[model samples]
Target: MENISFNMVFTLSGLKESKVNRYIYFVFVLIVYLLIILFNVTVIVTIILERALHEPMYIFLCNLCFNGLYGTAGFYPKFLSDLVYGIHLISYNGCLLQIFVIYSYGVCEYSTLMIMAYDRFVAICKPLEYHMKMASKTIGRLILFSWSFAFLTVFGGIVLTSRLRLCGSHIDKSYCDNWSVVKLSCLPTTVNNVYGFFVILSAVVQGLFVVYSYMRLINACRKSKENKKKFMQTCVPHLLSLINFTLAILFDTMFSRYESRDFPQSLRNFLQLEFLIIPPLLNPIMYGLKLAKIRKVVFRHHRQIEDSLHTKKR
Candidate 1:
C-alpha cells in the first residue's frame, strides 16, 4: 500500500481469511445484496408506477429506499470483489469515495426521516395547514435540502481526512470509513475530531426533533380515531425504521469507535455488518407491509401476475 497521497492504498484487514470461508462469505453477501436491490427497487418502482401513491409520504419512502441502495453500493461491490483476494486493498481515492457515499447515506437517512416526521406532525397536529405547508414545491425543496446537507457535510469530513499524512495503511474493518482512515494518520486530528463531533451533534439534533414531532403526533392522535389509525398505519413504521436504522448504525459506531479486543472476531464482523444488511432489506419490507396503499398495489399486481400465468398455462 503506497502512502504518497495520490497513489496511497488501504489494506482492509477484516475479511474472512480461509479460502473456503471467503467463498461462503462471498455467496452469502451476494444473496443479501441482490435481495436489498430487489426489495428497494420494487418499492421505488411501485411508487413511481402507481399514480395514486404519489403523495408526500410515499415520495419520502421512495427517497429512503434510494438511500438504502446508495449506502449499500459503497461497500458491497468492492467487498464482494475483495472476497476472492488473499489481500483486500483499496486505493486512497476509492477509500474516500466509499466514506463519502456510506456516511452521506446515513446522514440522508436521518434527514429523510426528519422530513417525514415533520410531514406527519403537520398532517396530524396542524391539519388545516398540512396541504399548504407541505405542498409539492415544499417537499421538493425539503428533499433537495436533505441530500445537499448530506453531501456537503460528508465532503467536508472527506476533505479533512485527505489532508492528513497517513502513517499506516491497515484498517481493521470490512470497509473504508473516515474515522478508520483518520486513525492511520500520525499527526493530531483536532480539526477532524471537531468536525466529527459537529456531524454527530447535527444528527443528535435531528433525532431530538423527530422525537418531539412524534410526541406531538401521539397527543394529536389521542383525540381522533382517524388520526390514531393513521398513526398506527404510517407513523409506527416510520418510528420503527428510525429506531432500526439508528440503533444499527449507533451500535456499529459504538463498537467501531470504542470496542475491545476481548470480543470475538466473528461477533465483531457480524455486528459491523448490521447497519448495511438489516435496514436496506427491512425498510422496503416494512413500508411495503405497513403502508396500506403500497400493500394494495403490491397484492393486486401479484394477483394479476398469477392470473396471467394461469391463462398462459390454459
Candidate 2:
C-alpha cells in the first residue's frame, strides 16, 4: 500500500448497522442534539443575564455549559449527516479536527471542574478569603489557563498524529478519536504514545485534585451545620457532575484502548458515545436543578415568559 494520501477518507464502521434504522436513529439524535443545545444555552444565557450569578462559581458553570455545546458541535452534526446520507466517511483533515475538538472538550471539562473545585474550596472551607482568592481578575486568569492548557495538550496529540504515515483508513467508532487515529499508523507510535500517556496522566491528576478538594470540603462541613448546608447546596452538584463526567470518560477510554470487536455493536456504540451523550445533557440539568441561584433565576424568567404569553393570548 502507498503512503496515506492527504485527501484520504476514513470509513467509520460504527454506523454500518444503522442503515435500516437510519431515519429513526437520525430523529432520535436530532432530538437529543436539540435538547443539548436548549439546556446548555439556557444555562449560559441565564448566567450571563443574571448579575447576581456573576460570581466565580456561576461563571465556571457557564463555561462548563459552553464547553458542552462546543464539544457536541464536533460530533452530532457530523453523525446526523452520516445517518441521513448513509455514508460514514470523514476526511483526513476533518478527522484530525474532530479529534482536537472532542479531546480538547474532554480535557477542558476536567480543567473547568478543577477550577470550580478550587472556587468551592475557597467559598466553603475558607469563606473569609473567598473574595480575595477568586476575584474577577483571578477568575479571568483561571478560565484562560483552563482552556489554553486543554487546547495545547490536545493540539500536541494532533500534531504528532498528523505526521504519521497511515496504513489503513477505517475507524471503528462513531467519531474520530486520538487513540483510534494513532492506531491507524503504519509505523510505531512511540512519540504519540508517550505524549498520549502524558495527557492522560494530566487528566487523572486534575480528577484527583477535584476529589481531594471535595474530601477537605466534606471534612470541613462536618464541623459546622451552616457549612454542611452550604456544601449540600453548592458542592454536591459539582460532585455529581464530576462523578457523571468521570464515569462517562472512563467508559470511553476503556473501550477505545481495549475495545473488543466481539462485543455487541450496540454495546460498543454506547460505550463510545456515553461521554458525548450523557455529560453534556446531565451537567446543565444537574446544575440548573441543584444550584439555588440558577434555579431561582431560571424559574423567574420562565414565569415571566409564561405571563407574557398568557397576556398576549388574552
Candidate 3:
C-alpha cells in the first residue's frame, strides 16, 4: 500500500523510481559541480593573484565566485551524500538546515547577479561616471545589502517552516526543498505554504524583472552592429540562471501538487535534470565563457604573472 497521510507529499502526476535515476543524476551532477567549482575557483584565484584583473568587473566576478561557492555549499554536499548513503534517512533538523542554506545561498547568488548587471550597465553604458557610481565603497555596501537581504529572505523561510509540526517524511527529491518539507507537516501548513509562495514570488519574480529591465537598458544603448554580441554575452548567463530557477520552482510546485504522483516515473526523472543539476552546472560556463573581457583578463594576467615570476628567479 502507498504510504499515505494528510501530510503526504502531494506530487503533480509522476512518481519517479528515485533509486536508479538518483545515482545516474549523482554521477552527472558530481561531474558538473566539479567543473563549476574548478572554473569559479580559477576565476577567483586569477583575479586575486593578478594585478591586471583588479578592475571593477573582476571585483564583481569575485563576488559572483563566492556566491556560486555558497550556492554549491547549499545544495551539493547533501545531494551527493544522499546518493552515497540514502535519502530516506535525512533528519528533520538536517532537512530544515538544507532548506535554509539552499534558499539563502540561492537568493544571495541571484541578488549578486543583479548587482553585477547594474555594474555592467554603469560600465558599458555610463563610462563617464562608472567609477563614481560603482566606487569601492558603493560596491562594498551593495554586497552587504545583498547578503543581508539573502539572509532575511532565507531565514524567514526557515522560521516559517520551523513552526510546522512534521508528521510524515517521504521526500522524493535528492535534497530537502522548502515546499517539499512543508508539505509533510501534520499541522495546518496554510501559513507556511502561503509564505513560501510569496518568497518565491518576491525573490524569483522580482529578480527576473530586474534582470529583464537591465537587459532592455543594455540593448537600448548598444549600437546595432555591436548589439548582438553584447546582448548574447550579457544575457546568456542570466537567461540560463533564470531558466534553471523557473524550472526548479515549477517542478517543485508540481511535485507539491496531488496529481504529480500519477504522472509516471520516467517523465518525472526528466524534469529532475533541470531542478537538481542544471543551474549549478551552467553557472560558471555561462558567466566565464560568455564574457570576452573576463577571458582576456584571465589569460593576460596569467601570462604576465608567469613572466614576472621567471624574471624574479633570474
Candidate 1 at residue 244, lDDT? 88
Candidate scoring better on TM-score of 1 and 3:
1
- Model 3 earns a TM-score of 0.77
Q: Write the per-residue lDDT of candidate 3 for residues 191-272, one digit (tens) a residue.
A: 7768767877777666776667676666765665455566567665765666676667577567656436676666665565
Clashes of each: 0, 0, 11
Query: Which residue window of length 10 is worst by lDDT in model 1?
Result: 1-10
Candidate 1, 1-314: lDDT as tens digits = 44376577888876666899999988999999999999999999999999999999999999999999999999899989998776689898888899999999989998999999999999889989988998999999999999999999999999899888888888888888788888888889999999999999999999999989988899989999999998999999999989988998887888778977888898888788888999999999999999989999999988999999999999
Q: Report the Cα RMSD per candidate.
A: 1.8, 1.5, 5.6
**Candidate 2: Cα lDDT at 309:** 100
Tens digits of per-residue lDDT for model 2, 129-240: 9999999999999999989999999888888999889888888889998888889888899999899889889888887888888889999999999999999988888888
Stretches of model 3 off by over 4 angstroms after superposition: 1-27, 208-212, 215-219, 222-236, 257-259, 262-270, 273-276, 300-314
- TM-score rank order: 2, 1, 3
